[model samples]
Every structure is written in structure tokens, then in C-alpha cells.
Target: MGTSGDLPDGFGPTIGTLGEDPLVAGVIERYPSAPWLTVGPGDDAAVLDLSGSRAGALIACTDTIVEGQDFRRDWSTARDIGIKVAAQNFADVAAMGGRPHTLLVSLTTPADVPASWAHELADGLAAECSRAGAVVAGGDVSAGTEIVIVGTALGSLATPSAVLRSGARPGDVVAVTPGSGRSAAGWALLRAGLVSSAFEGLLSEHRAPVPPYPAGVEAALAGATAMIDTSDGLVRDALRIATASSAVLGSSVVLDLDPGALAASDDLLRAASALGVDAAAAAEWVLTGGEDHCLLACFPSPAVVPAAFRVIGSVLAGDSGVGVRLGGKPFDGEGGFRHWS
Candidate 1:
């Protein structure tokens, strides 16, 4: 909030229309130190000292959100954007069965934008960090045509081991968090301008995904063989685990799922019904439609699946590609989301 006199010549005097240094300084003044933070917000690089913890390894993930492409300002406020970005970045750490610790953010926006919007964005980031037991360690800001936010989350494994993508084997049970596809269905509703009070839950899910953070750690503790977050769609992410783990054993993996399982979420079905999307189209959204960030894990056995997860399918010996099966037969339809497609 102060002048940028201490900053270099190129930095602006006001926080609203500033160069990188003053913007960084503004962020520093707003956040305080946490117990685990050794150096925060004001150095060549922010530092977090995790040496005191028993974590044998660190998990890190980074993600970016672009205006118009990833989100619309009309659909999401500054705060919602901040929280959504944080949720996505931290969800990666959780997918690896880690406890999120800190986030480094980078923001770029038009010079004319109000400074208050930036503050709200930061507040949203902080709120999500608090929810995930993490902190805003540091970040940078710059000028751009549209709002762009990039967040990197550093986390520590709850246990010495990580629930990696390369752990599943033949006969492993495929499990997922409850209520998949609501975000995708919600997205459809938003596009159709059918957003009403009846679809509020789905709408919220699309805007701000609340991935089960603890479920990743719980899966790790329950001896989960492999895990992935469904940011890229359920089948696509499942294929990642299958592909990675299958390569280790030199055997192909198949994910056998029931369409009913994907359609099981009440909100998803309700939203689908409201829009008359029908059973087949809803199944496609469940399989595809990225950004849900739900955890999909493979347990050694169905019985070992933790309380937070529901067994939707099983891992089987097959070809390298992920095969979706319904009623013991190959299900026919396109599978999952593609970034460049």
C-alpha cells in the first residue's frame, strides 16, 4: 500500500499499476510467517523449511488458469478464480498422497484493472490455503491482456512413501471419490444458461471444486497401490495410472467400470435430468469433462478401500489402452478430455 520509492526505477509508485517489485512487495506486506516457513515472500526465492517434519519426500505441482480459455470473468469473481486455481494446484499434491504445505503464485492482468480485485484474489488464495493446511509463500505479478494465474504447490508426503501412478497391478480395485461428473454436468448447465437455484450445487462444483484432500492421504495409509487426480477427466487420468503402472510389469491394464457408477451422483443425475441430457450424454461427461480434481485410486483389494472412496471398477490384464467396460463388455463411446483436441 506504500510508495515504490524503495523499489527500482521501473516499478510504479502505486500498487494498482506497478512493476514486478512493488507488486511483490504488496504481497509480502499482506502475508505473515507460518511455523514451517523459513523464508517467505521477499527473497530471490521463497523458502519453506520442512526439515523438522518426518516427511521423507516432497511433492510439488504447478498449474495455470487463463482468462476466456479456462474461465470467464462473468462466471467467476476474482476470489473464485483465486480459490479455483489453488484447488487445482493443491489437488495434484493430494493425488500423490501428500499434505499440501505452501503455494507460490504468479499473476498477470491488464494494467487498468482495479487493485481491489487483486486483493480479493489473494484473499481467495489464502482462504483455500487455510482450508488445505497450506500457506501463500510468495509470487510475482505482471501486465497482460487477460487475467492469468499460475500456482505452484509444495507438499510433503504423509508417509515415507508416495502413492504413485506406477503402483497398480493386476486385480487391483479401482476406486474414486464420491460424486464424479457434477462439475462437467454443471459446466453444461452453465453453457446452456440453465443456472438456477435447483442446480446450485452443480454450479458451485464447477466454479470451485472441493476435491477430497484427506482422501489421498487416507488412500496412502490404506496401502493404495496407485493414485491420480481427475483434473484431466476420469478415464484419461485412469489411463495415466494404468499406463505408468502397466509399463513396470510389462503387462497391459484395463479399467472396468459400470456406467451406472459414473451416473451414481445425485447432483449429476439431477442436473442431467434438468437439462434433458439423457443417460448416454451424461455418461460421456462423467468419463470426460476435466477439472473435477477428484482422486481416483487403486487399492490392493476392494475391502481395503477407505471409507472416503467408492469402488467403481477394477484393474485387469489387457491391452495398453484403458478400456471402459459395462456389464463385462466393452462400452462404446469416446473416453475422457483432451487438452489440444
Candidate 2:
């Protein structure tokens, strides 16, 4: 029943009553009113003003992370979890060619979870929102058996129409932001118990990925034909755009990727060697890794591709259903993470 100011530094015996808990109060206190948020936390529902945008359309996306399924407390801190969830949601809005505007967060945790942990999680979420040019309007917290965090991001389009997965064309060029395979390599290192400082950067990325928040808007402005967030692996997500575009365009689409364009970086190669794996394994991580949250987009031509994006492949007419090919051969390697598999 103590105020947020009176909360102790370490984990308490259990979370207190919801009505008088410091965790909720602390989280509410952390967010202030913004120009876009007419009503913030401490209210039943947040009121956002979108009239300022030239394009009145709204973009919304939601993503969830569970305790054991999406993350582990031993490997990632509350702040890390917050950053990861926020980044993923923001990336979704960006992929749609929108500017991230506000976020609604919902958190459920076991009674054993400390108030400090919850507060830290709020800080992490707020920090990421600031980085993405957005705000945390409001959210809910409840008691549960395990930690569950969900983020619903609402954004405003910068262009007349939001870019979609079905907008790709046969002659479009495929491109991606700078990061790929870093998160997967980080996961590999963590799973193998290879916590050496040499792999700290990779481990950090796995814990909390830093997505290219601005590149989405940039691509849209530069006339990107289609775009997607690389939450799944490169090939899997690229295939998503191909499939969607194919259905709309009435022709099978194939994304022909150049292997040299996606070669493993030096850091990835080092991690591969340390794990007793070869460069091929490292390359697989880039191809099949997920959670990096980078932007994958198709432009009308290589000349129109934004500088922030690197040309990696091209769209082509396919003889069969939509698929991805590497070096002109159909890729058969495993896809990214999937539930119930």
C-alpha cells in the first residue's frame, strides 16, 4: 500500500493489491501528456489526436512476448524485454509506411514478480517509445501465472497510401536494412552457453534488437512498392510479400536473392567459429533468423532504393506458387520460428 516513492530497491515478497500497488502508480507516473495524447495513463482509455497528419489513416499492430516462450529472465532483464517488445511493434507500423505515434501496453505477471521489475519494464518501454518518436498512452497490468507483455502500436501514415505486402511488382528490386542474423547468432550463443565477452554484441542484440525505425518512412517516401518487417527470417518474410503480391498481381512471384549480398559478417563468422560451426551455418542464421525486426522492402528499381537500404535481390515472374530462391535455386532450408512446430 506504500506509494511508489516508498517502494524498496529489491524484490518484495509479492506484488501488493492492485488498487493500491506501487507498480501501477509508478508506471502511470512515468508517462506525461504529449501533443498527440490527449489522455494518457491513469484513465480508462487513451484519447489520441490524429487530425494533424496529412493522411488521416491509422496503422495499428499488436505483438506479445511470454516468459519462457519469447524470453528468459535469466538471459534478459525486464528492460530488455520492454525494448524488444516495443521495437517489434514499432517496426510493424513502420513497415506499413507510417510514423509511430503511440503505444498501448498490457502486462500480466505472477505475484512473485517484484514491483521494481515491473517499474523497470515501464522504463524500458518508455525509452524505446522515445527512440521511435512515439509515446506510451496507457496500458493495463494484471496478476497471472507468468510474465506476459503485449504492445499495441498505433501510427499515422506519412504518404497518401500505406505501403502493403501486396504492392510488389514483377520487376521490383528487393532490399533490406543493415542488420540480419545478429539476433539469431545471439540466440545460438546463449543456447550454447557461450557467454564470453567476445560475443557480447551478439548477445545484446538477441536480448533487445534495434530496428530501423526511420527507414520505413524513408522507403515509403522513395516510392517503395511493397514492404514488410523482418520479424521472421529473411526468406520467410520475403516469401510473405511475394505470396501476397502474387495473389494481387495474378502471377506467381519469386524473389531471387543474390548470395553474395547476404554473406555473413566478420562478427557472425567469429561466433560461428567459436560455436564450432562453419560459415554456412552463420549464413543460415541470416537467412532463417527472426526477431531482428529490420525492414525488408521492394522498390520500383535499384536507382530508387533508399540509401539506408541495401539491394539484395529482385522480384521476378515464377512458374510456380510464390517462393524464394537463392542464387537462382529454390531454398529448402528451415524457416524462422513457428508456434506449435
RMSD of each: 5.0, 2.8
Candidate 2 TM-score, C-alpha based:
0.94
Which 10 consecutive positions of candidate 2 have the poorest summed lDDT?
A: 11-20
| TM-score of each predicted structure versus truth | 0.89, 0.94
- Residue pairs in candidate 2 whose N, alpha carbon or C atoms collide under 3 angstroms: none
Once fitted onto the true fold, the runs of candidate 1 whose alpha carbons sit more than 4 angstroms away are 1-22, 29-32, 319-326, 331-335
Which residue ranges in model 2 land beyond 4 Å of their true spot?
A: 1-9, 17-21, 53-55
**Candidate 1, residues 1-341: lDDT per residue as tens digits?**
34554654334334455655656666567664688787888777877777786345888889999887788877877788888999999999999999888899999888766666677688788888889988899888887888889999989898778898989887999999975677888788988889798988888888888888999999999999999999888877877787788788788777777666666456676777888877666777778768889999999988899999988888888864445455466553345655456
Clashing pairs in 1: none
What TM-score number comes out for model 1? 0.89
Model 1 vs truth, CA RMSD: 5.0
Separately for all candidates shown, the number of backbone clashes (residues 3 or more apart, or on different chains) is 0, 0
Q: Provide the lDDT at 19 for model 2.
A: 38
